[model samples]
Structure formats: structure tokens, C-alpha cells
Target: MRYVFFNHQGRAVLGVRTADGVKVLGEETLESLLERGVDLVTYGANAQGPSVEIGEQDYLPLMRKPGKIICVGLNYADHTKESPYAQPDYPTLFPRFNSSLTAHNKPLVRPKVSDTLDYEGEMAVILKSGGRHIPKDQALEHVAGYALFNEGSVRDYQFKSPQWTVGKNFDDTGAFGPDLVTADELPAGGKGLLLETRVNGKIVQSANTQDMLFDVATVISTLSEAVTLQAGDVIVSGTPAGVGFGMNPKVYLKPGDVVEVSIEGIGKLVNPVIDEA
Candidate 1:
């Protein structure tokens, strides 16, 4: 089942996608429901609340506040080739704070400090349960669902130092939802799906999940070895080639540009670019 968090009457409400409209689950957010071990399959079976027209409500990030947002860099072979750094055997990971997250249809803030705001379209895996030292083979069992992410970057700040935290954690730069497509709805580990990014109606990045250097299973297993993977922890599976930084004439986002990140089965996450006030 697809799940979403939306603003209704100035309050955040959790809802499940239905054939007619979005079925209201409760006022509790997605993270809260997951924490409570709410059985999504049966939670709203006898719904008595009002259904909201999908496009009429304002969207919120799938999880308003995730415990952690772990991002993998250079996990795609094609992207690694376009990058300046040499491909490494291990996944290059980074942390993105919840402050950076924006919802689908929200505006991505392009900070005034630089005009090099770039986009990294990737698939995000949301964990259903918490665990540590998880085995690679069983990692898929922990995934709750999959969603799309636009790992928007402030290129200038990113390269300011070896650490990418500064650029990656800018408020409202990252766009992360529409709905979370349950893991069962897609292929195992979200593999074999087509992931693409389009900027203002033109395709910029295109690749298959199978092309990822380190698949979802490996990432989960590896990450779990060091940190306890918790429910609501998001793992952004990295982007493919064709980012603005990798282009001949850098094509950074400008005010009024619309960026759409689409993953097969999950759906498209669209956001507009706006100058920071």
C-alpha cells in the first residue's frame, strides 16, 4: 500500500492511497505510525474519516522527521566515472539532517551564496524495523518501502572542504516524497527499476537500479554493522550520471526551474527551485 503525509486544515495527517482518494489513517504522522508498529495493511480498513482529494492537499515529507538520513555517494558506476574521485571499493556515505528535507511539490531553496545548486535523483529506502549487524542476505526483510529523492546539492559549499555536510544539509534543499510504495509493490531491493531525473521537461539523468555499484542489500548490511538501523531511517541510494557538475557547461538550477525525480513503481517527486529569501 502507498502511504503519504499531508497537511489538512493546518495539521499533518497520515493517509493511505486509495482508488477513489487518499484514505485518512489518523492525525499521527508516518513516523509515529511506524514506531507504534501500526499494521499498515489493516490500520485504515474501517476508515470513518474524510478522504482528501489527492492533489488538493499540501504534501509533507514522507516522514516529517526521520531518525537519520544516510546518503551514499558514488554508488553508481556511471556517476563514479563522471566524478573527479576514483571509484572506491566501499560506499562513500554522508549524513543529511532532517532540516534539509522538503516535501513533493515544495520549492527547493537555492541559497544566495552560490548558483551551483545541482540535483541528484535517487531512490530512498525506508526501514520498517530496527536492527544491528544485519546479514546481507536478510537485509531486504527490514525495508518497509521505497521512495524517490532529489539529493539537491550546493556544489560550491560541498567542495569547500573534503566533508560534504555543509552543502548537503542546507534547509529545504532535499525533496523526498509523494508517497512511499510498499516494498512488496516493487522488485526485491528495488532492483531492475528505471530511475530518471528531468529538469524543466528535459531528461538529464537516466539509469537502472541494477546499475548501482552497491545494491540496497549491501548498503543495509554494511551500514548496520556500524550503526543500529532504526525504523524511519532513510537511505538515499545515490544518483546516476548526468549531474550538472559532470556536464561540459554546468547546468545548475535557477529560479523557476522544476525538477522531477521518477522511479519506476514508486512515482515521480517534483519540486520547483526558488531563491533563498
Candidate 2:
């Protein structure tokens, strides 16, 4: 089942996509529901509540307060080639705070500090439970759902130091939802799906999930060996080549630009770019 968080009557509520419309689960957030072990599929099927036409409500990040937002860089071979760093045997991981997350249709702020705001379209995996040292073979079992992400970056800040945290975690830079498709709704480890990014309706990046150098399972398993993965923690499976930074002449987002990231089976996450106030 597809799940989302949206604003209903001025309050944030969890919702499940229904044949009629979006069924309001409750005022509880997605993270709360998962933490309580609520059976989303069952609740969505049997619970009776108000429903709203999808386009009429305000969208929220799929999980408003994910415990952690772990991102993998250079997970796609082509992206690694385009980047300045040499390809490594291990996954290149980083963290994004919740402060950076904005919902679908929201504005991605291009900070005044730099005009190098760029887009990296990606697929993100949300964990259903917590574990440590999880075996790579069994990693798929830990995924709760999948969603799309626009890893909007402030390029100038990113390369100022070896650490990418500053550029990647700028408030309102990352766009992360529309809805979450349960693991069962997609292929194992979300493999074989087409992922693409478009700017102002023009395709800029295109690739398949199969092209990822470190697939979903490997990322989860590898991270688990060091940090304990928790329920509602999000893993942003890195983007493919053709990012604005990788393009010839180097295209970057400007005010009034619309960026859309779409993945097969999952849905599109569209956001507009605006100058930071």
C-alpha cells in the first residue's frame, strides 16, 4: 500500500492512498505509526475515516521525523566516474539532518551564499525495524518502503572541506516525498526500476536501479556493521550520472526552476527552486 503524510484541516495526519481518495489514518505521524508497529495495510483496509482528493491537501515529508537520514554517494558507477574522487570498494556514506527535509511540491531554497545549487535525484529506502550487523543476504527484509529524494546540494560548500555535511544539510535543500511504496510493492531491493530526473520538464539524468554500484541491501548491511539501524531511519540510495555538477557547462538550479525526480513503481517528487530569504 502507498502511504503518505499530509495536512488535513490544518493538522498533520498520516494517510493511505485509497481507491476513493487519500484515507486519513490519524493525526499520528508516519514515524509514530511505525514505532507503534501499526499494521498499515490492515489499518488502511478496515479503518473508516475522512478522505480527501489527493491534490487538495498539503504534503509532508513521507516520515516527518526520521531517526536518521543516511545518504550514500558514488553508489552509481557513472556518477563515480563523473565525480573527482576515485571509485572505492566501500560505499561513501553521509548524514542529512531532518532540518534539511522538505515535502513534495515544496520549495528548495537556493541559499544566497552560492549560486551552485545542484540536483541529485535518488531513491530512498525506509527501514521498518532496527538491527545491527545485519547480513547482506537478509538486508532486504529490513526495508519498510521506498521513496524518491532530490539530494539538492550547495556545491561550493560541499567541496570547501573533505566532509560533505555542510553543503548537504542546508535547511530546505532536500526534497523527499510524495508517498512511500511498501517493499512488497516493488522488486527485491528495488532493483531493475528506471530512475530519472528532469528540470523544467527536460530530462537531465536517466538510469536504472540495476546500475547502482551498491544496491539497497549492500548499503543497509554495510551501515549496520557500524551503526545500529533503527526503525524509520531513511537511507538515500545515491543518484546516477548527469547531475547538474556533472554536466558539461555545469547546469545548476536557479530561481523558478522546477525539479522532478521519478522512479518506476514509486512516484514523482517535484519541487520548485527559490532564493533563500
Candidate 3:
């Protein structure tokens, strides 16, 4: 089942999408509910709250301030070739602060310091439970669900240094959410799914989840060996090729552009571009 969690009346309103409409589940982030041992996949079958129409209001960060936001870079071989860096033997991971996150349908701000805002349409998984030294075979058990993300980057700032934190962490750049599709609804490890990205109704990046050099199971297992993975941590699987920065003219986002990232079995995450005021 698919579920949309947005903020309403200072409440973390979570609702499951049904044939009738969106039926409210509770006023808590999905991560929090999973931490409390609530079974989201099956609980909504009978249990539910009032139905409400949620709009783009309070900024919903999907996991809602999830403890860890781990991002993988250059996971796709084709994307790695387009990138300045070489393909890595292991996953290249990065971190994102909560301030950088924006909700679905929200505006992706182009900061005044630089106008090289680039989009990396990606798929991310939220952890239900986490632990250290997790084996690859059992990693999928920890995934709560999957969501779409526009990992907006300020290219000029990003290439200024080897470390990508500054360019990647600008406030209100990362677009997340729309809905969380439970793991059971999709193929194992989110494989065999087509991930396509579009800008202003034009297709840009397109690839399948199976093309990742480091898949979900491997990323989780590898990360666990070094750091303790906690419940609510999100692992954003990297984007495919066709980022504007890789283009000959190096296209960048400006005001009035709409960016969309859609994955099969999941839903579309769209955001309009606007200059930082």
C-alpha cells in the first residue's frame, strides 16, 4: 500500500491512499511509528483515522527529521563516467542535514551565491530497524519503504572542493516525499524498477534500479560495518546518468523550471524551481 505523510495543523499527518481517498492513519512520522513497533503495512488494513485532504503546507521531510540521511554517489556506472570522479570500488556516501530537505510539490530554491543547481533524481529507502554488522542477506528486512528524491546540487560549489557537503547541504534544495511505497508492494531490493527523471516535461535521466554497482542490501551491510545504522535512517540510492552538469553546455536550474523524479511502483515527486529571495 502507498501512504502520504504531510504536516497539517502542526501535526505530522500520515494517511494511507485508498480507492476512497487518503485515509488518515495518525499524527506521527512513519519512522516514529515503526520505531514503536507498529506494522504500517498491515495495520492500515483495518486501523485508520479520519480522512483529510493534505496540501503543500508545513514542510514534510518524509521521515521527518530522520536520525541519519546517508546518500550514495556514483553508484551507477554510467553516472560515474559522466562525473569528474572515477568509479569507486565501494559506495561513495555523503550526509545531508534536515534543513536541506524540501517536501514534494515545494519549490527548490536556487541560492544567490550560485545558480548551478543541478538535479539528481534518486530512490531512497527508510529503515524500520537498524543495527551494526548487518549481513547483506538480511538487509532488506530493515527497509520500511521507498520514496523519491531530487538531490539538488549546486555544481559550482560542489566542484570547488573534493568534499561535497557545502554544495549538497544548501537549505531547501533536497526534494523528498509524495508517498512511501511499502517494501512488500515492490520487487525485492527495489530491483527491476525503471527510474526516470524529467525536467519541464522532457525526459532526462533514465535507468533501472538493477544497474547500481552497490545495491540496497550491499549498501546497508557495508555501512553497518562502520557505523551503527539506526531506525529511521534513510539511504538514498544514487541517481543515474544525464545530470545537467555532465552535459556539454552544463545546463543548470533556474527559476520557473519543474523537476520530476518517478520510479515504477513508486509515485512521482515534482518540484518547481525558484530563486532564493
Candidate 4:
């Protein structure tokens, strides 16, 4: 089942995609529903509501205030080779603040502080349930659905220090969702799906889910070993090579450029660029 969490006419509402159109599931945010222990898989598929045609939803983040946004940096091998860091055996992980998230159809701001704005398109896994040290084999069952993410970065600030949080946490840089496609609608653990990133109508990065060194299950299992993964947590899987800074000529995002992140089963997340005022 596919679900869209959006703002319609100024009020937040949840909708489930149906044959008739988008069915108004309820006004409750996905975050609240999950915190209340609603089984999204069963609830989203079975819940019925009045059919509504939402032409252009003012999209919201998959989770308005996701408890944690754990991000993996070098899951894609090629991306690592293109970077200055040497490939490591373990996943290169980081944290993103909730304030950094933006929604689909929103404009990603190119900060006035730097012109080196870069885009890293990736898939974000939303968790329904989790616990400490959850086994890798059982990790996939904890997933609720999947969404797209544009892991936008400020290149100069990113390399300012060995740590990445400063550059990665610039507000409104992470373009998140148009919809959250439930797990039952796709291959298990989101495997074998095509993930592509485009800038200004040009294909800049392309790869497959199968290319990820650390898949969903592994990342979840690995993360669970450290902290408890809650119902509303988000894990942003890393992107492939071909980022602006990695290019020889270095093509960074500028004002008026449109960026898109498309995944095979999930959907495409599109955002326009704007200069910070």
C-alpha cells in the first residue's frame, strides 16, 4: 500500500493511494499513528475513506519530527572511491537533524554562505518497530515503508572538518517525500530497485539498490546494536557516485535548477532550487 502524508488546504492529512484516487486515511500524521502502535502495513491497506483528487499536495516530510535521522555516507562503493576517504569495512554513518528535512515540490535553498551546493540522491527507510541489538535477519520486518531523499550538502563546510554534521544539517536541504510506498509493494528490503538522480533535466547519478554495500537489513541490525531504533526513525541510505564535487569540472546546484531523485518502486521526489534570501 502507498501512503501520502501532506497538507491539503492548510490542514495536515494522510492519504492512501487507491484505484479511485487518493483516499483520505485520516488527519493523524504517520508519526502519531506509529507512536500509537498502529500496524501501518495492515492499517494502510485496509483503511477506507472518501476518495479525493489532490492535484498538487503541499507535501510534508515522511515523518514530521522523526525521532532520529541516521544516515549512511559511503554505502555505495563507487562513491567512496570518488571521495578522499579510503573505503572502510564498516559503514560510514552520520546523523541528520529533523530541522534539515524538506518535502517534495519544495525548493531547496542554496545557502548564501557558499555556492558549492551539491546533491546526493538516495532512498530513506522508515521504521515501524525496532529494539536494541535486533538481529539482521529480523531487521527487514521492522521497516514500515520507503521514501526518497536528496542528501544535499554544502561542500566547503563539509570538508571544513573531518565531521560532516555542520554541512549536512543546513535547514531545508534534505528533500524527503512525495509519498511513502509501503514494504509490501516492493521487493523485500528494497533490493534490486533502480535509484537515479537528475539535475536540470540531465542524468547525473545512476545506480541500483543491489549496488549498496550495506543494505537495509544490515544497516538496521548494525544500528540497533548502538541505539534503539524507534517507530518514527529514518535511515537515509547513501548515494552513488557522480556528485557535483566529485566531478572533474564540478557541477554544483545553482538557483533555478531542478533536482530529482527517482527510485524504481518508491517514486520520484522533485525539488526546485532557490537562493537563500
Q: Worst 10-residue stretch by lDDT in candidate 2? A: 48-57
lDDT of 4 by residue, 164-186 (tens): 98899898899888888888889
Q: Please provide, for model 2 over 137-194, each residue's C-alpha lDDT reduced to its tens digit, 9 standing for 90 to 100.
A: 9999888889999999999899999999999999999998888888888999999999
Cα lDDT for residue 138, candidate 3: 98
Q: CA shift at 142, candidate 1, in angstroms? A: 0.5
Tens digits of per-residue lDDT for model 1, 1-277: 8888888777778888887898887788767777777655566565667777765339998888888899999999889888889999999999999999999999999998889999999999998886999999999988888999999999999999999999998999999998898887899999999999999999999999999999999999999989999888899999999999999978899999999999989999999999999
Look at candidate 3 and give me any clashing residue pairs.
none
Clashes of each: 0, 0, 0, 0
Q: What's each prediction's TM-score?
A: 0.97, 0.97, 0.96, 0.97
Q: Once all C-alphas are superposed, what RMSD does model 3 give against the true structure?
A: 1.4
**Global lDDT of each candidate:** 0.90, 0.90, 0.89, 0.89
The lowest-lDDT stretch of 10 consecutive residues in candidate 1 is 39-48
Candidate 3 per-residue lDDT over residues 1-277, each given as its tens digit: 7778777667778888887777877777777887787777887777557766777565476766888899999999999999988889989999988889999989999999998999999999988899999999999999988999999999999888889988999999998888888889999999989999999999999999999999999999999999999878899999999999999989999899999999999989989999999
Best by TM-score: 2
Q: Which residue pairs collide, candidate 2?
A: none
